[model samples]
Target: MTASTDLLATFVARYPAQPATAFWRGIEIEQLARAFASDGVGLDLGCGDGILTDILFKRIGVTPRLIGVDIDPLETEAAAAYSFYDRIHTIPAQAIPEPDASIDYVISNSVLEHIPDLEGVIAEVGRLLKPGGRFYFTVPAPGFHRNLRGSILPGVSRERYLADLDKRLAHFHYLSAADWRAMSARHGLALDSATGYLDGKETRRWEHLSRMTGGLLHSLSFGKSRPIEIQRALRIRDLQNRMALPAPVASGIAKMIACPDAPDSDDIQSCLLVTGHRPRD
Candidate 1:
């Protein structure tokens, strides 16, 4: 099999049934890593569970001095088993434990959407990165919430249920590419590139199934096994075999599957990959 096919096979083996949207998100990050990865120190911001990072770098065939940080100790503990990160920190993204201007590269995978104080996090990213360092991330676009199940109700105003939905989904902001560029610019970072990912058809399916699955899990667990249901939905199938797989010999998994637009597509989906570089003094 080609390298991309091999990567997909490994992904399928690792996460046999991950949610369509999330699985694709990981794949997209793998693609971004091809350009954004550096051999110097790397930090994974909001690195919940660290599963994606573990698989991502392996697929890309490089391992820097990656540190994983998040606010959840439970998830961090789970992440510890993988050995993908040299160290891990449990702290708020805005209060990263790393020294100022020390990290060489920083990456966040599908993490920015959940942070409410987005500016604080952006500022912190700037503080942690060395001059000319880059921060690469993926987040829901402005259109994410539009087709979301909670954002549209037949009779009730979306405002009525939006808060509740955001809480359940851990979604705080779905920003535009322009918004990301502006936010990063304020933090002494320049927009490297920004582009949308995932097409509308897939996005609608993803959102619909996300709510549908969550509703089912709540019902099936007698509303008590919510945690397990969440994990299952996110496709954390194995607990013990956290060993890294050697990267496959081929690539292009992300471009072929997740990236719906190179630069010219007009259909609105839900997510965008944003890269910001810290300007050299």
Candidate 2:
């Protein structure tokens, strides 16, 4: 199997109950793995449960000096199981415990959009990074809402549906690449690259799968901060964790979820992979 296929298979096997998340994350992890530095003192911003980071490190086949941080203690408690991170801190993004210029890189995967205090977090990123330190993150584009299949559903108002969808996802920002560049510039992080990924069709498929895979129900019952809490309350994640599919069945399902779009596609993109760096001087 190709590397991309292998990644998808891994996620599918691990997250049999969250196939939509696994599918989307498989694509995302492949992109991150390709660019992530194998050596350095790195921080994983908003690293949830450390599952994705664990998978990423396994794929990269390295044990770098990495730290995981998140606001959710439950998630961090779960994250503590991963040996990949040197330390795990449960803290708000704006007040990371590390000293200034202490980190060689920071990665926040699909995380920044949910932060209302984005400027504060970016400012924190600027303060923590060493000279020439890199920052990598991914987020949905502004066009993501416009591309959703539900936006075009008969009898539904596109604006209302899109608005409700954003609220459901707890997304606060859908900035364009230019917007990211401008924001990074203000924070002293030079925009090295902003590449598009996950085209419109793939995005629509993702939306459909999310709803079909109980994501919509989770969204309805719990807000962004409540996912881990609710899951723990009901022990739903525990049950899901035990319900693994056979390898062949999981592979087939993963293939069905995988999109044909290259990790960085030029088509009307639904998401972005942005990279920037602090100036050496």
Candidate 3:
């Protein structure tokens, strides 16, 4: 095998999956490890289950003083298992458990899209970041719906498909570059950089496969929570972290993965990553 193929195979093997869905997203993030490097303290917002962040850092080979914050007690306990973060806090988005001007960097991965009050999160991110501190996040564009049209729901009405997705994913907004600039400006943050990833065709493939696998999981679990999701037990959580496999599924008109390796070429891409900073006056 050529060097690139060998690398890809190694990547795919290292980040194995049980449901085998969204495997591409992990590969995509690992490719952008350099951009995620941090110098001082760092925080992860909405750190669901924390497996992805753990896996990503392992790939990047950097273990900075990272703190994880999530609202779900289940997720916060799970976050401790990977031992990826130096500290993990369970709190609301409005209440980050950190002092002002203390954090050097913050990352919100695949999280901003699901929030109902986009402005509040932006405002709080501004509050937590130190001057010149950066926040890197990923959100899908408005055109994401196009991928869902024939891929996830064929013979279904547009209205129905959209409603189903919004309900299933609990999503509120999808933003373009213009939206990012406006929101960042309103929240006292400046756009440092941005890039998009996952083309329409590739996004459709990811979405289609995700739904199929999720359905299989739901049926297999029989609507009961899996024990490996042991929020009350740390030892079991750390040992069986593999249960966090398959990665969380995503549904939208557009799908985007966060990868700094991708070039900023297309506006109509599946996912966009925006790096914002608090500029000193």
Q: Which stretches of model 3 miss by more than 4 angstroms?
A: 1-21, 31-34, 151-155, 215-267
| TM-scores for every candidate against the unseen true structure | 0.77, 0.89, 0.76
Order of quality (TM-score)? 2, 1, 3
lDDT preference between candidates 2 and 3, better one: 2
**Candidate 2: stretches off by over 4 Å:** 1-3, 151-154, 215-230, 239-246, 260-266
**How big is the RMSD of model 3?**
6.9
Which wins on lDDT, candidate 1 or candidate 2? 2
Off by over 4 Å in 1: 1-9, 147-164, 219-266
Writing each residue's lDDT as its tens digit, candidate 2 over 112-207 gives 999999999999999999998999898888878767777445787877777777776788999899999999988888988888777676776788
Model 3 TM: 0.76
lDDT of 3 by residue, 11-106 (tens): 333333322234444434643464665668888888877766765676677776778888888778767876557888888787776788888888
Q: What does candidate 2 score on TM? A: 0.89
* lDDT (Cα) of model 3: 0.63
